[model samples]
Target chain A: MNNKVPNNRAWLLVLPMLVLVAFSAIIPLMTVVNYSVQDVLGPNARFFTGTEWFESMLNDSALQAAFLRQISFSLIILAIQIPLGIGIALIMPKRGWQASAVLILITLPLLIPWNVVGSIWQIFTRGDIGLMGWGLRELGVDYNITRNAGDAWVTIVLMDVWHWTPLVAMLCYSGLRSIPEAYYQAARIDRASKWAVFRYIQLPKLTNVLVIAVLLRFMHSFMIYAEPFVLTGGGPGSATTFLSQSLTTMAVGQQDLGPSAAFSLIYFLVILLVSWVFYTTIMHMQKDKHPHGGA
Target chain B: MSYQLENTQRGEKYTTIFSKVTPAQRRNRNARSRWRANCLLGLYLILMILPIYWLINMSLQTNSEILGSMTLWPQNLTFDNYIGIFTNSSWYMGYVNSMLYVAMNMLITICVALPAAYAFSRFTFIGDKHLFFWLLTNLMAPPAVFLLPYFQLYYSVGLFDTHIAVALAHCLFNIPLAIWILEGFMSSVPKEIDETAYIDGYSFPRFFVKIFIPMIRSGIGVTLFFLFMFSWVELLLARTLTATNAQPIGMIMTRTSTASGIDWGTLAAAGVLTIIPGILVVYFVRNHIAKGFALGRT
Candidate 1:
């Protein structure tokens, strides 16, 4: 509950940000919208296409497959990363050199570019010279990401886990640190079990950060590219192709402006709808606990 | 000890009587769990470092050595890969461009976001909630969706391939986050401070700079860290926006492949180099890192 005051002059403060963001977001979004409705044949030659692009895009079996694949990937990463990150955070040292070392080292994967993360995994999973790939082959597991769709999916998920789980851990660690030491002592004196302590004390304290972590992870994973693109190039089949690759292939690669623009609109709408649901649900949960009037 | 003192001060007689015998047993359990915690953390950290270790291993070897066989360590260790990056303008300038734009984006984002964040935290204005949500829609908007429009938008203004163009385009994403984080930190500041400053005859701008800003410096630090992260790590937009002059290091690494083959060693070396700036940024803000990540309304 912020208990914020009402002041119309505050709009003056927000005006600059609005202008800058609108310049970047609104103008381009309008361009996409324009393209979506018109069949752009050449620089000046165009025809009104109505809802044909949207109709076709909706009906297209490939786009539906990509949409389903996108949803599954997002769900899988969130399921794996959230709990794993929380576990890592709970066990992390609370203070000193070890803490700083762990914090920095944990962030190494996040610092690398998405494409390089892709490249790193690409090389590391190679059967010939790569460590994990060679090691797997040596163990006779038959791990070939380039030729196997299942292997490609597994590697992409692993790569994402490596790249992003640190973010969740960092968020949870911060949440945990904010807790007062007195709570732990009180729990200890009561002879609370470890699981009870976590369930009662840590989880409630971690709610805010966990919300942020989940929303961020969900959005980022839903829009994931570059890594999977470089690692398996959407691989052995179109099996690994997610929404972004499909859109990029349509929008930029094939230069099909009308349908790609329509796809972009629908894709943006799906994300907006999902996040709206999540945001409202979270807000409702928080409201029940604190019961305040303002944000 | 302080907790024990507080317990005794509260006249917690039953707790004190029972807790005496449990201390030794509890301490033993604590130590054992601590040991377990270390083992778990160590194993996780090693897995985290495995790919990085392999990258460093290859970066120190020649291309031929990398391709010839798999080795845990370099056989004929060399610095040619690193040397190539330093000696060449094309290679090194990519880093310069990336740092320049990242810094510029961070500066712009924080400046605009601070006032807006203060506004969001302190005052409810017209369409503020709707405005904030709309901005986040940009955050959720896929960069791939904006790819073509961005290229043309910049091109039309003759800002194409400029660092500022990349910086501005990045604002579409970073500003929303900056505002979100700063608003959280700013709201933690009580309304009484603003009123008290006004009572003392402090001007709005002066009070904000002298008092409000410093109070939320940790938030600002974390905001900078995240802004740098998103800007630096984003390739799809950065790569699309720049051609040659303002090419980011990520763009360079992907483009490093020659006709003969990809320069595996050089690419690995460049990847290693990219991680350095991030580490340095993090080190400067390490002490504030934990306090900083509490970036949402409670």
Candidate 2:
């Protein structure tokens, strides 16, 4: 550990990456910033409009509604997927080929493209042709994701869970696997009940993984586009129209690039800020417990 | 030599407290447990397989069969749908284009991420931790928020429809992930190796390429596979960034429902085909998938 190398060399290595990233990332960000402050009449026509788009985006009722709906959807998805994922992980076989088989099966859904997931469900949930719709009708449920707002909400939430819970379960499974056998043996010797073992040992050990799972699920679900776009098209009276859908509808469909760009920057900042808070808080917790910054 | 342990205690009326379990009864109990386990596992397997079975079944059936028949299994198994996709015009190109960009993105991500991760892992540079976390913020940011900027930016740069455009845009997320995964692996490596190389007059670039990279080869492989898979399956940005010449399979699936009613047959076929590369990558990296979820390992 007697290394005394100058750290300035580190920047040299990171410089190319930074430059490339800046070209694609930072420069575009600045362009968006520029556009948000101005207006584009056509390809060759433009005019400066300071804070106009930002003010409008702030007061836009549609954007507000979209934000609220997106927040609620994200919360609902997190509520359902986290517990369901943990339950599924807990019930998974402890060891052997059966465990491997279950892992592989669970991973299959995750490997499919998001649009394909939507298409599969879209076809599978059709009343006349899709199995879910047909079966629900036969069972007297009268389900139509396209017609009913509540149904659309349920369908979107369910689809999100189906697609994402595996990620949570996978993280939890790895966390569980890393727990030493000695811990389980100790619990057994202490005559800990199964519930007690889970509550006291397993849950505590799963904190970091679950924190990561929650943050990841929140970010991805909040940003979701293709699946919901395909499945609902932000329809049923805009019930499933989340923030991303709203932005797309404005920016691309309606060609309101100014407001959309402003909204997007704000949206990006919210996620960045929230993620930063979560990350720093987790690090602080780790430092408090480990006293060595978890290194 | 095994002792039977039961949760229940015998009543006081039981005369023989230490009664030996009969071999037949023990065999019956063992058989019952095994049967129970088998039944539970079999049921679990069925539930897991049914939806996938339905997907594949739908993919194989003709449009009429999918819409007209409620049969769980295809009545007449046909490869026409699958063939319909590849033989049709401009359809198969989606797969080729997606593969090309995904590979390019992975290559670019690894090259950028490896050195950045090495610097973050091995050297305590100024603003290192802050920069690392800043990169992570990019990783966590939603792609939708950046779609407009990405499009305009790429368009202005005259790279909007090019393969490199999508690949580089994707690096916004993948580079951060690659750095994180690689850093995790590199930090585990002892610093003594680098010091020894430095003492031997080996430069940083030479040491990193010839020595350090080989040591973290598995990490690189896993990161590459992950980057490839995520970029391959990603729909929104890829769709936004590329147009005719570089459209991915995801965009092709979207285009299925055009002026006509849904191209259900072709859509199904493309949907099935789109999953092939992801499945192949997952198959290759199945063993190391668990390692990437090492949340508490640090």
Candidate 3:
């Protein structure tokens, strides 16, 4: 390594970033901490309440329900997407013009704006004018996502799958494509079955990309707000109301900044804890298989 | 080389290959596999296109027609809905405001992330690793959690209700991701290049702008595109930060269903328009994302 004496050179490089981040991220976070312990009665009236807000937020049942709902939703989404994404990737054509066309079609949904995703689904599921609603009716299946909680759950889950599975699939495709042709040739020369080839070679190579996909999808699905908000309005009696919606309603609708701030902090901590567990466990499993650095 | 070619030809000629042994069976298996693959592909394509098809179908129908029918296609297609959104200022303002903040946010994210990412990738400074991880915490924190403080801070600073407020708020998330993606890319450049630049008497800024940036153009383009997409469609902070002057299409889409009932047609038309810019951007950058994801490490 070239030892340029650490002469504050890197600091100079990162100075502008730190300044921008301080204004937008650090300052605002400190402000949140300040608000978390204080009472906001009016613009001119403010008083410190210490941890009272945290104490109150801990006992709030609505917040608890929202937390549970969001966790379970994230779990379900990951369970569906990871496996389904792999299956789609497996069957996809590996070369030529058809693969390019297929890639575009698969990626089309990922490009749509989040709110428009919600809007499109909202109209698509409406019983009055929606094709899905109309098709289900013609098929003699009883369906009303707007009013029924079960239907609402199905709709949101399917919507998320439709939107995110492509991301997983694309990541997996890249991972698969990166495997050396020698590995495939060796497997074929050994008369290895398709399942054996995939199990021994393809799966191990895909581990890193899959890990990143799972982490990204987990975090995003946990914090999802706009899609469910636009679709159900967190309604059908809070069946679709996840954590972000609860935080929003508390802060904006009820003007309960004290509880909302505490709730938010707790939510952040929970995500951090869970993601740490996920990352660490994946590393442990990986190490058990390969004593040396796998990559 | 000639000896290797002769060895391969002799080996292949002696090997027992079965191209002619099971033609009928192979043809039957191929047909079956083709049919199975077609079914799966068809189903997936339908799943992907159904929602978009429905949105377009509804956009072409009137409110009365929508409420009256349970049909796949609109009985009478109309242009009134498209007309209403185009003619209405409130509807079009969403496009204008979203475009403005998205541009500003992109500019800020790039300017900041570029050098910060460069530092993280090219140099190991005090607490650099820890600081990088700390920055990622912003990624984990939901926009909803930060709403109260951001609103209060922006309000106190006299930045509320302006495009800058939303753009700055979005920098919270976008900056972290930009740094992460950019750093991954920057680290892949060989260290020898920097020494070469130094030997040529180029300063850090000159080296970065004139040489390094050009080398990592694809990575920078991908990061910029991703940031633009994230900020453009983000709703929670975008809504909380701006009310009257800088509201985005996400907020406008929500307010479409007010006391007057849901403007189904206009919402659909607007929804279709909202997706066009993102689609166009993705079309140009489609080849970059897959490769970019694993630039420095896979």
Candidate 4:
């Protein structure tokens, strides 16, 4: 969409956001870039080590493991959440008091603090006291996150699915609601099967929101820190040590500024690249669907 | 005449069979599907609420009772954990500090994003597309990356451990989100409205405040919700930027685990209390959430 009047005065409107973002985003980012290249020896002493940290960070086996773990975690989350969210959205009540009640109930998890989410799961999954833990124990299953890496990984993933799937469901619910009634009516007249209706009508209409949900879930899962940090502390032998946790350990815990800075850039680049691919691919798909540039 | 009567009777028999079988079968199918939908949702709801219910249950019980027993309901119900939080300055102050910073972040993000989103929706400016993408990149940039820099920068500027520092730091992501959401809502409003208001002698600020803002009130609400949620829940930046004076409840909750052991009851109480504010917010905006979700890009 374009306006006939060619005016640049609109920059005045966007100036505050630019300045605020620059202060919060660009300056700090530049600081990271600066630290990535130079070895911070002391409070005042530093030496230029051009790409040395980057080279070593790239070769660090632990960091490589973390990168792979991060990718797998994100992929798993997306795979599970996207379908589950759509399923819930499909079954969700369309209107009336039930709809409102369900919406409020479902969104409760999304609003809770991240650390608190971990804390809830932490206690909930404790074999000695919590309901799930005790129930599993009664069933003769030993479920302990602290002692078992598999348990810890499953607990972390489950915690995330519980926390974030509502977001995708909510987005899909909105997208589903926006579909014109006429489409469904037309399908009914044609005697379209339930799956056919969903595949052709609902899913196609949900493409926009699905794109948003996928990208949002991907970015969020990639940057996940607090929940896993609080829940497992990237523990049980580093089975759940994702990218952010690794960066946090280096930058905050160990104070390894140069290497952590390099790690941060790499992490940022990975997210940016993936998000860009998602954005372009989805946008191209939309363009192809509408040859006349109609939204 | 006998042959004609037999043919009509045969037609009637076929009609009866069709009517008898189809409607009952359809009703049964509908009933069965509805049952299935209810069961699926019912199971999901249980899964969703069980942890929360467990938290609440633990909050109402003594530490020993929680650890020693696995009964469904609290064996010995008590409010001591909650009472402890309300009475303690450190505990209660965590809530206050979190609320203060979250509110400030919401205010700052909306104030800055409104005009910027307007620019993006209304006019094509130099580097507009690039700048928009750049802003969004900040949204995707992990908060972990900024923790070190934010700590050093805020300490240097004497804003460390202040609510303002955390609020400002949260702007890194919230502002971009606010702009994106507000931009989506604003673009749906026709450009002709702005021109008509201006032609009627409404100044820019007057028009924006009186007309445009109300039109996008739901957008603002959604932006506010997102900003509030992110700031309230964000621990890394908030934790890094603050210490005692401005410690958020989230960070404070982590202090429960020490050399001794975890304080199950008190931690549960605090966790339950943390969810209350968000619940209240959702309740107020419950009606707008679906609409807001549709309007807001993300």
- For model 3, the TM-score of its B chain against the native B chain is 0.87
DockQ ranking, high to low: 1, 4, 2, 3
lDDT of 4 by residue, B196-284 (tens): 99999999999999999999988888779888888888988998998899999988887788899989999999999999999988888
True contacts kept of each: 0.69, 0.50, 0.54, 0.69
Candidate with top lDDT is: 1
Displacement of the residue B76 alpha carbon in candidate 3, Å: 3.4
lDDT of 4 by residue, A36-111 (tens): 9999999899999998999999999999999999989999999999999999998888889999999999999999
Best candidate according to DockQ: 1
Error of 3 at A128 (Å): 1.8
Question: Per-residue CA lDDT of candidate 3, range A1-295, in tens?
Answer: 1232344578887888778877877777776777789898988998999999888888878777887888899999999999988888877777776777787778778777787898888888776667777678778889887689999999999999999999898888878888887786666456466677788988988887888789889999999998998888887999999998888888888988766777788888888887777656655764566574321
Q: Taking the candidates in order, what DockQ does each have?
A: 0.59, 0.47, 0.47, 0.56
Candidate 4 all-Cα RMSD:
5.1
lDDT of each: 0.88, 0.78, 0.80, 0.86
Best of the two (1, 3) by TM-score: 1
Question: What's the TM-score of each model vs. the native?
Answer: 0.96, 0.90, 0.90, 0.94
In model 1, the runs with Cα more than 4 Å from the true position are B1-15, B19-22, B296-298
Model 3 clash tally, residue pairs = 0
| DockQ value of candidate 1 | 0.59
- lDDT for residue A165 in candidate 1, whole number 0-100: 98
Residue A240, model 1, lDDT: 92
Estimate the Cα RMSD of every predicted model relative to the unseen true structure.
Answer: 3.2, 4.7, 4.7, 5.1
Candidate 3 reaches a DockQ of 0.47
